[model samples]
Each structure stands twice: as structure tokens, then as C-alpha cells.
Target: MMINSTQVSYFTLSAYFDTGLFKYLCFMIVMSLYVLIVGSNLLLVVVICMNRSLHEPMYLFLCSLFVNELVGSSGLFPFLLVQILSDSHTVSAPLCFLQIFCVHYYGAVEYLNLAVMSYDRYLAICYPLQYNTRMTYNKIATLIALTWLCPCCAMVVLMSLTSSLQLCRNTIYKVYCDTHSVVKLSCSDINVINVYGLIATFSTIFGSLLLILFSYVRILRVCFSGSKQTRQKAVSTCTPHLASLLNFSVGACFEVSQSRFNMSTLPNVLRIFLSLYFLTCPPLFNPVLYGLNLSKIRVIFKSLISNAA
Candidate 1:
């Protein structure tokens, strides 16, 4: 079917609009979620930046991760809140692709940041003598820059390729626009975008996962061989990073699976929740988990709470 690219100026968000009779209730719930996500993430970012003690490599990475959550949540929640309130969930073509870029870039950077954090932990725990020299402020700055830069550059290319596609469909089934969903809508040959996207996704996902595993393996080796105090300290530091990683990984898996698989058998409500879990859950949970688990952060956060009371 030949279709004019110019005609597809906007796309409709169809699937996620199935809130039925509880639309207003849905609005309130979504609004509240957005508030918590923004509040929690921003609080962490602010606390880290404000405190001199958290200027270390590990906390710097955590700060980057929190900033990423804010960016990722901004990409979806504001638009989602607006959509839940509106009668028609129509989004302009440019805005849709922009959202797609933000979402994908966020995911890619998230994994990369976690991998970097794991490596930082490994160096601190396993190589305490050289940890300071190796993980200098310059190195930390470079890692942070690369994490954000690589993803942004890749997403720009993906969007560039997608923008030229002759799209036949103007309705996206998922809650938000993503690379696969937008490329799949193309009316013509999608081989270029598909291949490039597969390469990007696989590299970003597995490459980071492997790095994280290597870091942890070395850390585990060191912990097992260390004294009681060392083991306790390693456990205390590594537990929170591992927990945040597990939380984010599950959400990332759901996003990837929902995009790749034909989940038509699932009910709309289930599908909707699954599709958006990445945008909502990790951002909300990571800050809370890390704040509670890390002793230094916990104390500072407590002091802040007490002072404000």
C-alpha cells in the first residue's frame, strides 16, 4: 500500500487509552505516580550535588543515574498525564519521535551507568590502594559524559533513519513511541533501520551486562578472600547497587519484550501496565532503595528530614 509520508503528520496513542470507566481514577493515580517519580529522583540528585561527601566516583554515578531517571520520566509522565486527561491521545510526529529518542537514550545510558557504577565499586572494594588514583574526578567525568553521549548519538542516528521512512500507520499501540514501534509502522523497506536498531540494542544491552558481571565477579572474589570488616563493608556497598540493577533490569526486560513479542493475548490493562513499568517503577524505587541502604546517605537524608520538621 503506497502512502504519503506527509499525511502522517501525527500519531494516535490507541492501546493505552483503555482505562474504561475509571478514567478519572486513572488520572489521579498517574498524576500521583508522576509526582513521586519526579520528587524522589530530583531529591537524590539535589542531595548528591549539594553534599561534598558524595562527590566520590560511586555517588557521582548514582547522581547521573538519578538525573537519567528524571530525564526518562520527563519523556513520558508529563505527556502521559496530559493524555489521560485528554479525549484524544494524538501526538505530533516530531514530538513522537522526540519522545522515542528520549526513551531509548535513557535506557541505553541507564545500563551503561550501572555498569560503570559496578566497576567503580569493584575498584574501591578490590583495589583499595589504587582506587583513588584510577577513579579520579577526570575519569568519573569522562565516564559520565560517555554514558550520556553515546546513547544520545545513537538515538539521533536511529531517529534520523526513522524520520525518512514512509509510514503507513498513524496509530501506535504502546504507551509511548519507541524505535521498534515507529520503524515497524514504515510502509516500505525497513531493513536498514531494523538491522541498525538490532545492532544498537544488542551492543548496548549485552555489552553493559557483561561488564557489570565481570565487575561483580572480581568484587565477589575479593570479598570472599577478605577479612570480616572488609566483607561487611563490601556487602554494605554492593547490596544497594545490585538491588537497583535488578530493579532496572526487570523493567528494561519488560520494555524490550513488549516491543519484540506479539503480546496480543494479554489484556489491555496488563499490557498497558507492563509497557509503562520501565518509565515509572525504576525512577521511583532506585532513590528510595539506595537512600535506605547506603549508611551515609541514610544519615544525611535523616538529618534533612529532621531539620525540615
Candidate 2:
């Protein structure tokens, strides 16, 4: 018998282990992390916005990336804190779907944002003489818009497809709601949704990856043939971007493996840690990586701090 999606009121998150008094400790730890993520990402966003000197394509993209960290963290941390403290690990249907949407959207935006940044860097490095002409304000605006809009559109369809499924169960095996976990509960055939989901995921992930690859290939050719100054310029700007990309890709791989494959033999604690790694780490990681690595942001940030002090 198929249960309508509307009838499934809550999803029980089976992965949360009983921690008893440690629940308070967990709550505090999670809360502290959330506060740090918000504070750091927000600081960078404000710094970029307030300082006219930092209003370049790269900084603008960084600002958007930092804002996305806020969006992704806000979607998960509060809900996680509540669940951590509560005896019941169930989430409301509407809230579950909302979390799913936010998580997916956050990921999509991050990949595309990185891809766009790579392209920007490509222009700056490969064609320095024409970088200004190529990366005009209007063009930057359009790139940013498409980066966000594409994901928003894809996620809306993903959410709709998942929401329409006739769920035979309401137990999601992870700490948070995700498309794969929720879809696993469906009583009806999910071939169409699954296929569509695969296509969307592939196009978003690989498509961005391809663009990044192409950008960097051309970049490498220039670095090999050009002067030392050209290589320095490429290294200084591209290092943080590459590091951030690699870190996020690792986390994403862990998530995909855990979600798509059977890993019941792994320790619950390890599994949980791996599952939360992607969402938790990147928000905190990106701000630190960029803030410390990029000299301009670092100098401006330090000045802002000293002046305030």
C-alpha cells in the first residue's frame, strides 16, 4: 500500500545515536560552530561590501560564496541543534523538504560559483591585456545571476519530484533530510525521478568541473610559456580557489558514497561525521582559506580590525 506524500507527516532520522547527557555538550559544540561560521562568513561579506577598493570580480564572487555558506549553515545547524537536544529525531515533512532544498541548492551554487571563478581567473591570467574588457560589470552580473538561477531552477524541480513521491516509510537514515534518503522511502516506482536526478546532478557537477578543467588547462599552458610574473599572478589567485575546490570535492565524494552505497558496517560515529563533513566544514573552511590566502583581503581585513580596535 502506498502512502501519499501528504500523509507522511514526519521523518525519523535513524542515524542519531543516544548520547544522554552528552546531548547538551553536543548542542553547545554545534552551537559554537554555527556561531563561528556565521560570524566569519558575515565578516568577510561585510568587508567586501564596505570597502570600495575590494569591488572586483573575484571579491564579488567570494562575497556570493560566503553568503552561500550562511545559507547552507542556517539551513542545517539550527535544525541539528534542535534534534540533538530532543529525544525524538523526527523532522516535520515540510521542514525536511526545506532542508533538502537548502542543502542541494547550497551545493549547486558552490560548484557553479567555483566554475565561474575559475573562468574569471582564466581571463585574468591567460588574457591579462584584455581581462578588463572581457570581464565587464554587466558580464560579471550575468555570470553570477546564471550561477544562482540555474541551481534554483534545478532544485525546484528536484524538490517537486521528491515531494510528489508516495512514501511508504518516513525514516531517513541520516542526521538531516536529503534527496536520496527521502527518496529511498518511496513506495512507488522512482525510475523517472531517479533518472532526472542523475541527469541534473551530472550536469551540475560535471558541467562545472569541465568548465573549471578547461579554464585551468588554458591557464597551465600560459603559465608554462609566459614570464615568472605571469606564473606568480596565476598561483596567487588560483591557489585558494583550487584548495577550496579540492576540499569541497572531497566532502562531496564522501557524502555521495555514503548516500548511494551500503555502509552499514562502518561505525555510526564515523558515518555521522563523514555525512556532516561536507556541510559543516566548507562554510568554516572557505572563509578561512580565502581570508588568509588572498593578500588584499587579508590586509584590508587586518586594517578593519585594527581600526575597530
Whole-model Cα lDDT of every candidate shown, in order: 0.87, 0.93
Clashing pairs for model 2 are none
Best by TM-score: 2
* Per-residue alpha-carbon lDDT of candidate 2 for residues 158-239, written as tens digits (9 for 90 to 100): 9989988888888888999999998889888999899999999999999999999999999999999999999999999999
Candidate 2 achieves a global lDDT of 0.93
Error of 1 at 27 (Å): 1.1
Please state the error at residue 196 of candidate 1 in Å: 0.8
Give the root-mean-square deviation of each candidate in angstroms. Answer: 1.4, 1.2
Error of 1 at 203 (Å): 1.6
In angstroms, give how far residue 184 of model 2 lies from its true place. Answer: 0.7
On lDDT, the candidate that comes out on top is: 2
